[model samples]
Target: MEKLFKQVAIVVDQDDALVKNLENLVSLTREWQSSFHLIYVVERPAFSFKNIWKGYANGRTQPFDTAEHRLKEYQEKLKKLLPEGTRIHCYCKEGKPLWLIRNYIHENQIDLLLLLQSGSRFKRQPIRFSQLVGKINCPMIMVPLHKKDYDFKNIVLPISHELPLKKIMIASFLAGKKNDARIHLLALQEQDAKRQRTENPYLFKTYQLIRDNTTLTVECHPVDGDNLAAPTLEYARKVNADLILVKPGSETSPPGIFHRLLSKFNFSSSGIPVMTI
Candidate 1:
């Protein structure tokens, strides 16, 4: 049988959250028994005197050596966690963070991309999920820094009348791989009563498709709420789900006071690990 994620790539940056990210990755590698590529990009400073002055005045050392040092440290850390004979490659490069990371993933034919979903304090611009989700070639996992000891046992998959084939397929594939794992399908309801009537038939159709195709256990529950994140999360907590399969439309809520009140319910800030293709 072929591996689900043959060539996994993880984005490394300067943040305290990186430790949690690495821990989660280690957990995944342990379960899958797969190798991964660790990439750290030293972003170039803007061509401004103020930027130059800040670097000099702050006595900030050159980024190449620093990046290498961090990479080595992380390499040692990962080795301690991963099983013996597991291959690990580390790359340190200088370029724009977004462009370089995306190009590298494409050039290397990465199967999965792991990104930490928190902002960095020192960097001018961190790698934002909204910017790279559409640009990347492979599926991306936005790992929440707070969520540690990640497992693929219970996966939350949000469903709509339109039916996301990719998300459903991926959920099924993952559930099939894990022992005693189950997929929870959260059927999203529309506000309009006319549209809501059509949703149930599609939900049943989706339920039937998964039940017929695979032997894995699956459940479909109707979720009611204006915001997708709230009800989905409520269900996840009830089921003790660890992973969420989300599309860009329902997951990527715009940043504002409303979003802030919900603790910024976007790709990275969902307080749960979210995957988008």
Candidate 2:
């Protein structure tokens, strides 16, 4: 299989949990043969309190030197610690962190964005997370504070009518890359799965097309109830899913809010990359 994720980046801050996050990035992309970039945004402030304390505090260390210092340190650590021959780059920019991160993701053609929930520069505003889900083109792996092993086996996805199969297939392809990882699909509506299979065969077509001789399995189920997120999570826990894929379009539709709130959870443990299309 071809490696689709060749370039990956991690958005970091002075206070982020870099040690564990970096370790996970290495593990997640080891198969991809990927290059890692450490991105630090200075967060261009909108107002006040600048000249009031502009002098160097500790000799060469200025008021704003801490972030830069941390970024440089991370760069050294990444290059020293990553697998031999792996490429590592560090970037530090002063601007709105979101825009800088977005622009960097686009310009660098980053295939994945690894972020730690704690010490993130942005306040983890639901709107910001929702916006990233709706706008950013890369798949992101968001790690929570507690460290737990998440696997691809029993990967679950919530598919709505508006969600594109191609997008869902992206996740399936990723999970299926590992032998024995099963991709389970759940239609967010109350409609019957057999009926939908009859009505729109493409909704269930991923298995036939994606799985061939691999241990990866594909199956779709109708959620049969309201509040799709809860049921989806419940089913995922029941199946012991290591990851949950939010179908495309759920980020922009009415369930957008649900996705936003759901972002707060530490889904990475189950191999849930905490990603959107």
> Who wins the TM-score comparison?
1
What is candidate 1's TM-score against the reference? 0.80
After TM-score superposition, what is the CA distance of residue 151 in candidate 2 from its true location, in Å? 3.5
Runs off by more than 4 Å, candidate 1: 53-62, 119-125, 177-180, 190-196, 224-230, 254-267
C-alpha positional error of residue 11 in candidate 1 after TM-score superposition, expressed in Å = 0.6
Query: Please, what are the lDDT tens digits per residue for candidate 1 over residues 1-277?
Result: 3577878888876665676467666765565666789888876667799986786455332468987998888888888888888888998898777888888888888888887766443443346666676688888887766666565778988775566677777777666556587888877565555554334456777778878977778888876665566677667767777788876555444236677344334445556677876
Per-residue lDDT, model 1, residue 225, is 61
The per-prediction tally of clashing pairs is: 0, 3
User: Model 2 — which ten-residue stretch has the worst lDDT?
Assistant: 54-63
User: Per-residue lDDT tens digits of candidate 2, residues 109-189?
Assistant: 998777666534433321134446556778766655454565556667766554355555556556755667777777644
Candidate 1 pairs with clashing backbones: none
Specify the poorest-scoring 10-residue window by lDDT in model 1: 260-269
Error of 1 at 216 (Å): 2.6
Query: Distance (Å) between predicted and true CA of 202, model 1?
Result: 3.2
